[model samples]
Target: MIPNVLTIAGTDPTGGAGIQADLKAFSANGAYGMSVVTAVVAQNTRGVGSIVAMEPEFVAEQIAAVFEDVRVDAVKIGMVANADIADAIRQSLDTYAQCPVVLDPVMVAKSGDHLMQQDDVEAIRERLVPRATLITPNLPEASVLLDRDVEMSSLEEMHASLEELRALGSQWVLLKGGHLGGEESIDILTGHETVELTAPRVDTINDHGTGCTLSAAIAALLPRHGYIDAVRQAKKYLTAALRHADELDVGAGHGPVHHFHALWNNAPLQLQGAQR
Candidate 1:
């Protein structure tokens, strides 16, 4: 059966990130996607201008509604915005702890706008991180979680930072090295073991929704396959998505990666089934 994945995140009106990006990534990666919006942001490739957070109870209701009807195999979480929403998500997931949860610790947007509050980081670290199956954090987000400056100058420093993050509670930690200046981007997956996956950095400035897309892709692939295989496949999918990032121009600034690139190219057929 096809896996069903749910995303608990904010709404990106531009459809480049948050729940919109998660759904697109999930669909592209062959999983049925569902969403529970925790907040809504007025945003685009330019930047985020305003945000409207959903009440904690309302967020809980949305999650309950989805879980009541769908058999979610995995979940990807993004931009909770505040502590109340984070707490609500933590509580809701506690009851469904068996599901594989991928936490994309999104603190700031690619356009340099804060997506999560600084005060709420501790709540996320304390309440949510321990429960996640995997936590995907870029260098800056990892720094915030680990309370140290992540040195991008060397791979050893990066590996050490990832190990420190792994001690925080996640069963697995995929520390993204995209922020490190280089021709190639290396993402290290460290948990039971460390695996280094690298992709030549696409020369495009459009990487707005890459994090959301990556985590969503991983969530979609994990249940239908297995964790290690899913990570390998998801990396390839993300690299292809990034390569096609320049095809479409959605906004004036950093735009989204093309999540449907494979489908557009008529890729090899897999199990053509629907998740219910």
Candidate 2:
């Protein structure tokens, strides 16, 4: 069976982040993509202007609607703005717990605008984090979860944060190092094992939906590959996207990664957004 990946996230009208990016990432990683929108964000590569969250009951209904008919291979959760949505997702996910869940703890936008409520942090930690097969967090998110100042300037710090984040609950934790400026970007993965993946930093201003893309890619690959192989493949795909991100020329500020770089540029079938 083809792996069908589901993304539960907010919407970005600009189409670089949120549900849009998840869809692109899933498609790029060879999976059929589906989405349940949690919020409609009035934002762009520059920053978030405003957000309108979906009702808790409605979000729960969307989850039910999808799970009832579709055999989801994996679930990627992002940008659940409030406690109600968090609770709704956690409660609804119980029926689909057999499918692996990849949680991308998206608390803020790349432009530093807070996308999640401060009060909802505990709810996510208590409810959603435990159920997650894998949790991917950057330095700031890990710091918020641990309630401490985590400076991820060094590999040692990244590993420590990984351990602390794993303690909060998650079968595995991936601490992303993109936030830390270095010649090489390193991401630390811990749980069943401690592994560090590093890649040369791609200097570009286009990284709007990176976190969502990486987590979604992981989910997309899980149904077909081993945990380590999936993560490795995701890293390779993300790196290529980052390297060619400038070609998109999306906005004046940060743009999106070239998610369909291979498909639209060099593959046998030249699949564009609508065509896919």
Candidate 3:
């Protein structure tokens, strides 16, 4: 059977992040995708203009409907706008506790728009983080989650931040270091053990939905493979997706990575280390 992955997030009209990006990543990684919309945003590659949050009850119903009919292998969650929506998502995951979940604690958009309310951050911390199998956080999100500044000055600091985030109940933490100023980007995976994956930083302003894509790819790979194996696959997949960043023209500003690069080119996904 095809692995089914579900994404609970807001809708991005420009298809860079949110549900759109999750679905794209799932498909690119050989998983079938579904979505439960929490909010609808008038956004593009440039920025978000406005947002309309759906009722908590409606979001619950959408998740229930998918769960009732589909054998969802994993879930990727992003962009829960308010506490009510976050609570609803938490309840749904509680209802189906066996599914592996990948949480991308998306606090702010690449355009610097606030995707979540300040008060809801605690709700996500207290209720959602513990339930997630893996939490993917960049340096800024890591700072917010740990309630301390994460200095990205060195690889050692990045590993320290990953360890701090792992203490926050996630079975694993993929601390992304793309925000750090460097010629190479390093993402450290900390859980049962620590492993670092590095890639040459493609200096492009077109990286819009990178975090969303990474987390979703990891979620899609988890059920079929072990945690460490899936993380290795996800890192390899994301590196190629980043390398092929120049192939798309989805929007006037900050286009998404070329998720379909493998399908078009038929290149093998390469991993830097052993697959678990």
Candidate 4:
């Protein structure tokens, strides 16, 4: 049977971030995607207007419903809206303790909407981070986790953040450097091995779901590849998605990365983006 990947995240009406983007990335990487939404967001390319969080009981029920029959090869988690939701997910995930979990701490949106509460932050750091096989955090989210400001502008800072992130309970940590100013976007991976993956920064305002795309890609690839290879391949996928981001004019504000750009294009760069 084909690998079945699961994403436990919130809803995105814009289809760029959260479960929408997660499913797209999983399918793009050749995985059968499943989702359990923790929230229904009233959002668009412009920004998040409001959110209706799912009840903790329903979240647990959804997870049970999926695991009872389907065999999930990997799991990606995003945007736990509150402490109750976090606890519910953690308890449900405990039943399937052996599965590799990809945790993307979705604290804020591209347009600067706070997706998580302060209490949820503590809950994730204590509950979910320990269970995650891999934790992908951007600079702002990393800062919140470590309780200190994190800047990845310098290679030294990147390495430092990677170490601290691992210490926070993730078996491995991927610190995304897209927010750092540079000619290239660099991501640092630390835990099993320390390596830096860099890609030429795509000049576009339509990178609404880049983070979700990347973490979901890693989750999809982890069933077939080691951490390093999975991260490398995911980086390549994200770069291509970003390169072709302008192809889809989804909204007036920050749009989404083209998740299926590789499947559609099959151009040389689609495979060679991460290496360059």
Local distance difference test, per candidate?
0.87, 0.89, 0.86, 0.90
Per-residue C-alpha lDDT of model 2 across residues 1-276, encoded as one tens digit per residue:
789899999999888999999999999888999999999999998999999999999999999998999899999999998999999999999966578899999998999999988988888888999989999888888888787764557777777666678888899988998888889888988879988898899999998899998999999999998777788889889999999898787987789999998877775554466463
Clashes of 4: 0
Question: Would you list the clashing residue pairs of candidate 4?
Answer: none
Pick out the ten consecutive residues of candidate 3 with the lowest summed lDDT.
Answer: 147-156
For model 2, give the 10-residue run with minimal summed lDDT: 267-276
Q: Assess every candidate by TM-score.
A: 0.93, 0.95, 0.92, 0.94
For model 1, the run of ten residues with the poorest summed lDDT: 267-276
Residue by residue across 143-233, what tens digits does model 3's lDDT show? 7887776446667788766656877798988888888868988888888888887878887778898888899999989989988889888
lDDT of 1 by residue, 1-276 (tens): 988899999888888899999999999988999999988899999999989999999998888898887888999999888888888998888866468999998888888888777888998898889989999998888888887664456677788677678889999999888888699888899888889988888888888898999999999999977777788889899889889888777889999888898787677434468455
TM-score of 4: 0.94
RMSD of candidates 1 onward, in order: 5.0, 2.9, 6.6, 5.6
Candidate achieving higher TM-score, 1 or 3: 1
- How much does candidate 1 score in TM-score? 0.93
Pairs that collide, model 3:
none
Q: Tens digit of lDDT per residue, candidate 4, span 1-276?
A: 578999999999989999999999999999999999999999999999999999999999999999998999999999899989999999999986468899999999999889877767899999999999999999888888887763446667878667668888889999988888779998888887888999999899999988899999999999999999999999999999999999888999999999988677765445545764
Better of 1 and 3 by lDDT: 1
lDDT of 1 at 123: 86
lDDT of 1 at 170: 94
Off by over 4 Å in 1: 149-151, 267-276
